[model samples]
Target: MKLLPVFIFSFLLNALAVKGQGADTLKRPIAVQLNVGTQGIGAAVNYGVYEKLALRLGVNAIPIKANDVFKISGFNSTSHVSADFYNIHLLADYTPFKQQPWFRLVGGFAYFLKANGNVRIIPSDDYKYGDLTLTEDQIGYVDLNVDWKGLAPYLGLGFLKTFPKRKFNINLDLGTYYLNKPEADIIGTGILTGNSSQTEQFQSNIKNYRWLPILQLNFNYKF
Candidate 1:
């Protein structure tokens, strides 16, 4: 993951050199972009290699956490939920119509450095056995974890041109990433130790949760 940016930068420099030697009429230019959306905030470098074709290399990260957002149907508990995702991607933008430069078909693949979700559930109220109240540690907690870390393919559409006519431009990307299958596990402590048996069922239920939707807005600056 640490070397990804170096590779992308090297590739961008090579593309620039090639563009510099091309014909003056060729619409090959380089741009830098910043974006934000469901995938989180990120930045990318855009290189126009042809009049209707461009390439982008970028990285994105989404880290979110919430408290008391989840609960068991018949249990009184407080849950902490968190999701963290980090990826590096390379994308191609192709304009199918010369007259419609503002519309583009986007295809890409991302390598996720980290993709994980966690839920920790703790009993909110004290439990009593006969006349004795059980301590929190005696009642214990349950932790559910899921990881989707691998290559994901992206397919989307872009609105607005890949490059600015002058210095800056704004665009939108509407897409979805099909993530790899996830690995899930359940851990329990103290009285909840038996919850670990549900790991298999949890994995089965989340097998199909691979689609990650993206609605991103990009701000571009031509160089």
Candidate 2:
């Protein structure tokens, strides 16, 4: 329900006696998720904290197309919106009906690092924060650039296996939030609309505003 300012995640740290598995019914699966391209190099590690639960930590950089963003805000606005993220998550996995379609829900908390950008909407040549000067071009073209860099929550769904032996657990998750309620930011309610209050302008930065869908492919080595 809240986004913490920082993320500290540990890998599959449980003691698995059977080569790559746990001694009993428990196991810690240390893994690495990679981005197929050079532009997106996101990586993460997950753990098996409980039979029906897992936790993870990851670091990723997600950037929106400058031209696409410019189309929405004209050429004068840039978003300092939180896009670059260093996050950690705690998830709850449940397999209610093991005979039906393979389904799992992962929910957890994470810290959103302040986004870093090169297109400036805010002029930075005149401002200074912690020993660095920012350019307006580097800030992009949005007026309300607010970053929730402390804490945030995420939830996603994925598949554990297909048919028969449940060979692997391939997953795809989308974090379920933009920012905490009542918080001030340049998205969601913070965005103003004419004619009506029903608008979808703040999806790119409030919480789970990934530039692209988060695709995770995992290989479970069990004993």
Candidate 3:
């Protein structure tokens, strides 16, 4: 039994060596890539460490804003929605088959420098306080905020090649990141003060929201 285990391990090592030998070797040691997709626009630097392996260091960010997107029944409200996300990551790419150099497995970890989403709703016209109409300034606004600003682990697959066969090439990525537990809260002013009580429920609803999907395209240039 002991000898059988040793034989299996040796066979695996030999198989790995043979796979590496058959892979298309990277002619360039370093390359720069521009990434565009759901995570936003970013850039990465890749370093070929072995024939079938490479390391990537990258950064990405997205900032979004919208107006008049949220409202409640019987209320003339204007809402502003904003989201900002920033991340820095280090990833590894490995080509498992020499015959399929265009396919690769990717794994990485990212530290979110900033990840926050906010929605603020303000009365567009006037609010009736029982018998009187309250001004917009008096009614104020309600703000709902959620934050997921921490480390995340990523796993995905890459298509095409890591580096260009010529000088430039394009690749695609499909992946997802497992984010940390998110925190959520509500803050209100004036008549909206009562909405703050909903913070606990908001937090509960988003507690399990940990997956961040990614569909990206990368343009790479060899150096």
Best-performing candidate as measured by TM-score: 1
Pairs that collide in candidate 1 are: none
RMSD of each: 5.8, 11.4, 6.1
Which of the two candidates, 1 or 2, achieves a greater TM-score against the reference? 1
For model 2, how does the per-residue alpha-carbon lDDT over 119-190 read when each residue is reduced to its tens digit?
223432354556866554433333344344556555556575311233334454533533343222332221
In candidate 2 the C-alpha lDDT for residue 78 amounts to 36
**TM-score to true structure, per model:** 0.87, 0.48, 0.85
- Expressed as tens digits, the lDDT of each residue in 1-223 for candidate 3 is 2353354345445545755675675343789999999888999999876767777899999898999777778988889999898999887777778799999887777899988889998878767789999977679799999999998877788999998887899999899877878989999998888999999999999898888899999999998
Per model, how many backbone clashes are there? 0, 28, 0
Q: Model 3 — TM-score against the truth? A: 0.85
Ten-residue region with minimum lDDT total, candidate 1? 1-10
Task: State how far residue 209 of model 1 sits from its true place (Å).
Answer: 0.4
> Of the candidates shown, which would achieve the greatest lDDT relative to the real structure?
1
lDDT of candidate 3 at residue 46, scale 0 to 100 = 92
Check candidate 3 and list the clashing pairs.
Answer: none
Candidate 1 lDDT by residue in tens digits, 1-223: 3354454455445545655566577966999999999999899999887766699999999999999888799999999999999999998777767899899978778998999999999988889978999999899999999999999888789999999999999999999888889999999997899999999999999999899999999999999
Instruction: Report lDDT (Cα) of residue 180, candidate 2.
Output: 42
Task: Rank candidates by lDDT, best first.
Answer: 1, 3, 2
Q: Which stretches of candidate 2 lie over 4 Å from their true place?
A: 1-24, 35-41, 72-83, 115-144, 161-169, 181-223
Candidate 1 error regions (>4 Å): 1-24
